[model samples]
Target: MSTEFHKLLFEISEALVTDELAALKFLSLDHVPRRKLEAIHEPKAFLEVLQEKDMIGAGNLFFLKELLYRIHRIDLLTAHLGSSREEMERELQVLGRAQVSAYRQLLYGIAEDLTSEDVRSVKFLLQKQLPKTKLQENASMLQVFLEMEINGIIKEDNLTMLKDILQRFRADIKKKIDAYEEKKKENYSREEVRYPVSVSVYPEEQGAEGEAAKQHGKIYKMKNNPHGYCLILNNHIFRNPRYNREGTLQDGEAVKRVFKWLQFETVEYMDLEGKKIYETIKEYSKKDHRNMDCFVCFIFSHGEKDKIKGVDDECVNIDDLVSCFTGTNCPSLAGKPKVFIIQACQGSVRHPSVAVESDCSGPLEVDASPLTSIPDKADILIGMATVEDYLSYRSRRTGSVYIQSLCEKMELLCPQREDLAAILTEVNNEVAKRELEGSKQMPKITSTLLKKLIFEVPQ
Candidate 1:
């Protein structure tokens, strides 16, 4: 065997003996797949199977399985690994006249029940099967088993992979400890510095015309005065009346009104045809890195979960756009919040509005693709207009029900409450009560905020 393979074998053996049981118990709790567990039997056997099938190493197959189990629990494991009575009989027949012991049967039963069992129960079972001596003696082989089990547990947790959780957890703990130590070492004499915040508003279609419409309406107005450095990317090309294809003229009108109510500094009305939006965001994120506290992108366009459509009918993945502001590229906003407000549809799942006397508003349609990936460390707040599969309504006279309600709530609730989440909750409640009445779609708010954010200018 090659050095890397040999190292793998050694690691696997160690995992099996020392930490395999603990890891397996965790996996069982998460509901890892049987196939994944089976692969951990022996590296030689695994290699042989691969060789026979003309395959390579397990790749990410085992890792993925473990990851699923961790997020979902043991129910998934039973569903994937449980064998029918007929299949069991076939296996017995293949084994010839040899009778299977009760212990062996119990072991199989436990394996099958791995998904249903709790972490403690799994640990007990694993301990019964592999004693400490066996684990310690064959530590290398055990490592592989442990790795497989760990993967399964993480899977049940609904994560991308086991390695990610492990790495993140370790990093987070270390960071916390470091922060604590640093705090302790520092003197309390220096005055704290208050970070300055910048807000940018991007109105699509209607240019200054949209801004004019907002002034006419009875709506909550955002202050036009620029607080700090801000860049607004507006789609001026769509402002023309000729672009109204549906004949409803609703979108164009809404854009115009929203622009009127909106406030920002240095507005750039560029055609978001190709990858202009992504490139623009990238360039802006890089500019004035030292003074910038964070980055915000408010996109008002027709969109799905992964993509947003431009005026000239171009598609851009939200991930590609957001990646530009990550810690690796834009270190200024590393620990700071990166807020992205998306006023679009996620998917096609709509929920009926319930008739209730209570003040709380029911959920609207579930957005098709809810945010799947938002880094734990980075603060990312995503506010969607309507739930999945439902149309976000816009009146000829008034603006979108959700947006109108949001602005109203921001004006009223933000001053009293400093927390952004609390403000959003009020917005949700208001939108639900006002916009969701007799309507099918409900507005939604999703966030991965690292710390409490004060929306109103902090006193």
Candidate 2:
């Protein structure tokens, strides 16, 4: 047997606390005597003897397998030894639901500054964060998170929400400490006065390329200005690192440039994990964008049927991404265009193989949920790279099929007074005509536009 296999055998023995002779008797092997198994001191040798005597059968293996399975540790079995750590990762992904992950990070962040004596306070904070019933159910999970924080992995990149929560907690803690210190001081200096920082940058209007548009019995210039903000969230690296996206930065650059040319102040956030994506949107939503005209957000990341993976490998629902900016939540951008362009596979399903002379075509079924039922809010547009339940192709050399075509079409058509819907339609047609890895792709756009939004280019 290979060295890893031998090592696995020894590890399994260490995991099983039953006596060697008792374990052999439990196996109920007819050929292997309890005394002969007792002569073997090492687990590897015992396993070898079982194989040599041809005593390794399904029934005999169950004795060991059942013990491991009972503890939910079957992954430590010899056949799965090498991938045991991966099993933990998969479990964490499933366990880290969106709300749970967010709260987990928050708790982890607060726990970092806590001392051994602060355990009671930490537990109290955990209870305060959730209701009593929910806290009871998550008690064990919270213990695991506390262990992860002590190990130094909880504060890493994937748990930004936690870190951000920690930051807020730290600030409050510092304030309390400072207040206490002030009371103890007899002669303390007055707090320094700080003035607010200001900016001189103002919105510049790009003169209309042609005639003005008539609105409310008035002729308004068809000029575009930096009326609002454009957020570009591009996630490439992930906790597993295997799913790290290449050529995504190029796609983000294309989006930033196009949005900048359209006079929107483009802000780019790179390599966010699942919770941070929501947190970032929520943070941005809190900002007053009443002075701005429209809002646009672009996401380039790996996706599933109806969700996108954060760098931490957690999946977040796509509707939650848009709903963060809905008029109800973010009233500053209300009644203005809120556009989202997502470039991720809608599902795992691939294109069907076709015969040259075949006249019958089969309908494609996506195994994932439909990317629909976005809240019935006006002025929201969602642009998906592919139709429901299909993969969106990206090249290691160039960028994604959808983004490249979308940018090219936008640059070509935006100056011509084409509405965003019309421009995206052209993009869909352009992407559909191209084939990647022998599969065709068509983009999907769902919109509730109250009016036509055009990025009027300067002459």
Candidate 3:
């Protein structure tokens, strides 16, 4: 490694705490032996072992970047690695690119998502399986998982104990494990079926040209490794507890999952201030997208007519956010697709984050508030959660109905390369069918897109 690169690793190593090192070890178990990882006491030693095994280096830093991303250390990525969360996410989509196993990532993600109380519950469930020392209060979830693996309780192919425990409190996280297992089984079945494999003389050339040229003749080009930045501005908490958008984080997660699957560099900014939202949007607009295809943004927060409210209760006009991507303002993305999905209420009748409807039997859901329109900029599309005078619904447990429903539709339809309009149309229909507070929410899709904006994901 170069001296500079060595210095970078040194800095990163110094930054990692003990718990993060445990996470790094657990995630890297597939590559590094269990016995080897257990002996590694510090970040520097662990990284050195990785370097010795050629898992990370100056030429191949993907694994290194992934480790930081796995531990939710985007600051290290930006400051030291000269990369961002968006950049790493885009890179992660490349075929066979990820060093960490999906099973391991899923476990680590669940561990991070769990609260202290949740961890205690998990430990209580595992008390009989592991020793007293391993299930202590001071023991982190990652450490508990290590104990499970050591005791032959859960493995790469067997996560029943973990799944059963998680399903009690976090069905969503448990569902992830189930999905992974299902996909694994599917892959096995496909391999056993013996599908035909065509071998072209110039496979690389044809594959590249075929993907780039097959955009239905007259549509926006969507042939980049990363289609574009899928920026998510989710404000879940405010200074005042009353204004907290409880389920907004779930919306951000849903958007990030779908867009990243579509091969976009998904970057999420949480609980941004009124001024910060504008700054973040403008910052992305200022980025050079010469190598990108389209830009997608999801702003899920509270707001009023033609405006969005930041965590600090500051208001930013919908037009101002859209203007940042105007042809003149953002020249690089001039003719490219710019999509903005807003999840908030629009009318003066502000919807409480959680509400107990008097007419209804239960206090089932809360709501987010907004209505928005783009400027006269061609190729810009805005999908508002609700129409000009209605409240949008959000779940304290799940997420906003608009965004979650949209992401579900995108995942279902995008495999066939569905256009943005078709996807949003499906979203509108799906969300419209639901009755919140015994009323309906009609999502508005304002489009100036001259050509169809289809997203072609990584193979």
Question: Which lDDT tens digits does candidate 1 get at residues 348-457?
Answer: 44434433111111233443454556553356666667654444544434435555565566566656433556766776676666644566546676676656654423
Put down candidate 2 lDDT per residue, 99-181, tens digits, no spaces.
11232333433444455544444445556444455334334433535344455544423454333343454557444334444
How does model 1 score by TM-score?
Answer: 0.43
Location of the lowest summed lDDT over 10 successive residues in candidate 1: 190-199
**Regarding TM-score, does 1 or 2 come out ahead?**
2
TM-score of each candidate structure, all chains considered together = 0.43, 0.50, 0.50
lDDT of each: 0.44, 0.61, 0.79
Question: On residues 196-249, what C-alpha lDDT tens digit does candidate 3 reach at each position?
Answer: 233342256456445534433456777787889999888877877677877777
RMSD of each: 19.1, 19.8, 24.2
How does model 3 score by TM-score?
A: 0.50
> TM-score ranking from best to worst?
3, 2, 1
Better of 2 and 3 by lDDT: 3
Off by over 4 Å in 1: 1-271, 348-368, 435-437, 456-459
